[model samples]
Target: MKKYFYNNIKSKALLLTLASITLFSACEKNDDLKIAPPTTISDADIFKSPARIEGLVNGIYKALKGASLYGGRFLLYQDARGEDFINVTANNYTAYEAWNNSYSSGSNDINNLWGAAYTAINNANIVIEGLAANPGVVTAQKTSEYVAEAKLVRALAYYSLIISFGQPYNKDGGASKGVPLRLKAENGPENNNLARSSVAQVYAQIIKDLNEAEAALPQNYTSNELNTTRAHTSTAIALKTRVYLTTNQWSKVIEEAVKLVPQTQAPFSTTATAVKHALQTNIANIFASDYTSVESIFSIPMSTLDSYTGQSAIAYIYNTNSEFYVNPTGILGDAQWGSTDRRRSFLRLSSGKQFFRKYAKPSPFLDYIPVIRYAEVLLNYAEAAAKTGNLVLAQNLLRAVHQRSDASYVFPAAAISTETALIETIWKERRIEFIGEGFRGPDLLRNLQPLPAKGDSNLQTPAVPLTAENYIFPAPNTELSTNKLY
Candidate 1:
C-alpha cells in the first residue's frame, strides 16, 4: 500500500516543479537572516538541469493522495447521494435523501467538496505554470505529455466541482456561482479573494484542459501500473465523452465515444470475461471486497491501516447492529437480494438494518476506490451507437451485460428497439449493475431524464420528488464568506 502511494511521487514531483516556476519568486535565505540571494535560476540553468524538473512533475500525482479529493472524500459524498443507499440517521447525507434545503451554505458536504477540488486544481495550476516557464527542461515530446497529463487531472477536478456545485454550469438557472478558477498557486492574500466562474466558463475551461490533455498525453504510458493508475489519453477522451454527453453535445459525444472504444484495451470488448468483468461470476466479491478487476479503469487506493477508512466507515454507518444476521434496512434493501441473487450476500442485516459486509470485518483491509471504469466506456459506446441509429449495437451491449448476469432471465427484444427505449434500458441496467458504486443519480439527471420518486420499483425506496435544484449543492459557507466570487 505504501508502495502504491510512493511510486507515483516521482512523476508528480516533476509536474509540480513546472508549476512552481511561474508562481514563486526565487529567493534563498541567508544564514544570518540578513541579505538573501535570488532563488530564480536562468531558464537555461533550470532546463539544463535535469533533476529538479523531474521532481516537480512527480509532485502532481502525490497531491492526489490528499483526503479531500481522491484520497477518500470525493467518492464518499458521491456515493451518499445516489439511489442505492439512503442515509437513515441522515447525519451527513440528510440533504441528499430529502432532496430538501438542508444542504445550505454551512453544509459539510458543500465545504468539503469545495476545498478538496480546488486543492487539486491549484496543484495542477502550479504544475502548468512551472512547465510553461521552463519548457526546455525535458524533451519537447515528453514535456507535452506531462503538460497534457496535468491538464487532464485539472479538468477532472473541475468537472467534479461543476457537477456537484450545479449541473450544466453554464445552463439556464444553473448555480449562479460556480467553482473558482485557480490558474496559479494561491499562496497569499491576493489569491484568497478569488470569485467563482460562471458555469459556462467553467465548462469551457474543462473542455480546454481536456483538449490539451488529449493532445499531450500519449496513447499509453510504458509503465504497467502507471498506465492503469494515471490519467492517459484514453482517460481524457473518456472524460470528454462524458462531459459532452452531459452538455447535450450529442454529435461530439458520439465522436469521443468512438475514439474511446478501441482505446479501453482490456476485457471491455471480449465476451469471454464480460460477465466476470461486470461481477456476474461472483457479485458479492465484486461489490463487497477490494477486488481490482479489469473493469476498473481508474480508482484511489485506500488501505485500512495506512490511511483513513472511508469505505469501511460508510459500511458500518449504513448497517444495523445485529451480531448474527446483518440485514439492510427497508429504506435500503432489495427484497430479492437474499433469496435468489448471490450479490445479496454482500450485505447482511444486523438488528433490522442492512449492513454492508464488504468492509465489515474486525480488521482492516486494502480497498481501491474507483474513479472510472471500462464499463462506462462500454456504456458510452452503446449510448452513442443508439443515438446514431445503430439500435442493434446498443441492444447487443445491454444484452451482453444482462446475459452475463443471469442466463435464466430471458433477454427482452424490446430492450433495444428504439432510441428512447434503449436509453431507458441502459439507465436501468446501470442502476442495477453499478449499485452502491455511485453513478446512478448523476447518470439520470445529467441527461435531463425524469427520476421516479423513491417508490418506483426500479428506483425502489419510496416515491420522492427530486428536482434540478437537487442537482446543485449549495456553496460551502466558507467559500461564500471568504471568497468574493461566491
Candidate 2:
C-alpha cells in the first residue's frame, strides 16, 4: 500500500510538470526563449497551484476506476459469487475463482483488487494531508470542499475493503480483523508495518469521515455530470444509508435516508438545493444512452478515450461474448420476476443464451458504471423501515420500486402480509434491480446468508456457508509480504 503512495506521488508530479510545460508553450511566443522543467517536484510544489491541486483531487477519483476495482471486476466478482449468473467460461483470468469461492491469498484477483482499493485510499489520504498542510492553495471554501471530497472517496474505499476482506458486522458485531487502517499519508516504505484494526474500528472511522464529508460537501454541483460523478452532500448521506444498513443500524438508515428521500409516497425525490434526484419514470432510461439521469446518485463516468478495456469491460464479460449468463435456476427462475416486468428487458438472448444488457455499449464499452442510485436509497430506507416494524412505509416504498418497473403488476397479498415477508420482497427486488450492478454478494453477507451454489453438473460450484474460510476474501499475499505487523 505504501508502494502505491510512492508511485502515485511520482506519477502525479510528472503529470503536473508536463501540464505546466504545455500551458507555457501555448502562451509563450518568443522563438529563442527556453524554460527548463524541474527534474523532480516536491510534495509542496504539487499543491502550490490551484490547477495542480485540482489534478490531484481528480486523481483520487481516477484511482477508484482501476480495472480490478470499480472499473468492472469488483461488480463482476460480487455477482459471480452469488447465484444469479453461471460462468460460461471457466477462465481464472476473469472471476472464475470468485464464482467458485476458491480464491486464496496469493490469487491474482484478490491481490489486484486489494492493491487497487488501497491505492485509491492512499491517494485520497495524500490529498487530504497535502491540502491541510498548505491551507491557502485555494479559497478556504474550496479547500474544505476538496478535503471533504477526499474523505468521501477514502470512506467509500475503506467501506469496500471492509466488506470484501472482513467478516460481516452482523456476524460478530464487527469483532473480526479488518484490513489495516491507514489514515495518514505515507510516501515511502517507512510506514509499511501496520496491524489490522477490528471491523468495528474501521466502520467507526468510515462513519467519522462520512459525517465530516456531509458537513462540508456541497449540496450539489453546477451540472448534472458533476453531480452524478462527484461527491456531494446528498452523495455522502446516500452512502451513509448503505453503511448504516450493512451495520444493521435500522434507525440510522432511516435518519440518513430521509435527508435525501424526504417524500413518504411514490415519485419520491430529494430536496437538495440544486440537484434534485428522483427515481426515473422509466427504469430503462437510467441505463440508456444518457447516464446522467437524476436517478444516478453517483456513478463512475466512462468514455471511449477512458474506459475499461478487453475483458475488464462489464459488457464484454456479461454480454458481448456471454462469459456469464443469467442462471435459469437462480433469480431468473424467480416466479415473482414476471415476464411482463420491464426490468426483464435488460436480459438479452443470443445463440440460445441469456445475457445482461444494462451495459450494452459494444467493443470499447463506455457505459457509466453506477456506484449508487436514488432507487437504492429508497429501498435501503424501505428495508430499514420493515426491520424497525414500520411495515406501512416499507410496503409503500417497496411498491414504488416494483411499480416503477412493472406498473401493472401488483404484489400478492401474502408477499406483503407481514414485516418479514415485506423485507424478503425488498431483498428480492434488490437482486432484480441491481442484477448486473454488484450488490448481491455484499447484500447476502450483510445478512449473514450463505452464497448459494450455482451451475449445472458440468461446472457446479459448492455453496459457501457463512462459516466457510472463503466467505470473505483473504488478505492478499502482497500486503502480507510487505506489512510485518500483518
RMSD of each candidate? Answer: 9.2, 5.1
- For 1-486, candidate 2 gives per-residue lDDT tens digits of 123343222232223342222221101121111234544455647779997687677777777878888787899988899999988789888889989999999888898888888878877887888898898879999999989999999999899899999999999999988979999876667677889999999999999999999999988776777788888888899999999999999999999998887878877888754678888888888887667888898888776446777777888888887888888888888867889999988999877767888888888787878999999999999999999998888988998988898888888989988988888999999999999888999999999999998897568898999998999999887787778787
Query: Please, what are the lDDT tens digits per residue for candidate 1 over residues 197-314?
Result: 8777888889999998887787654443344456667677778877876676667876776664543322334232211223235545544453344455455554433344433233
Give candidate 1 misplaced runs (Cα > 4 Å): 1-55, 93-101, 169-177, 262-293, 303-306, 310-345, 349-354, 357-365, 449-471
Residue 28 in model 2: lDDT: 16
lDDT of 2 at 305: 47
Q: Cα lDDT for residue 341, model 2? A: 90
Error of 2 at 324 (Å): 0.3
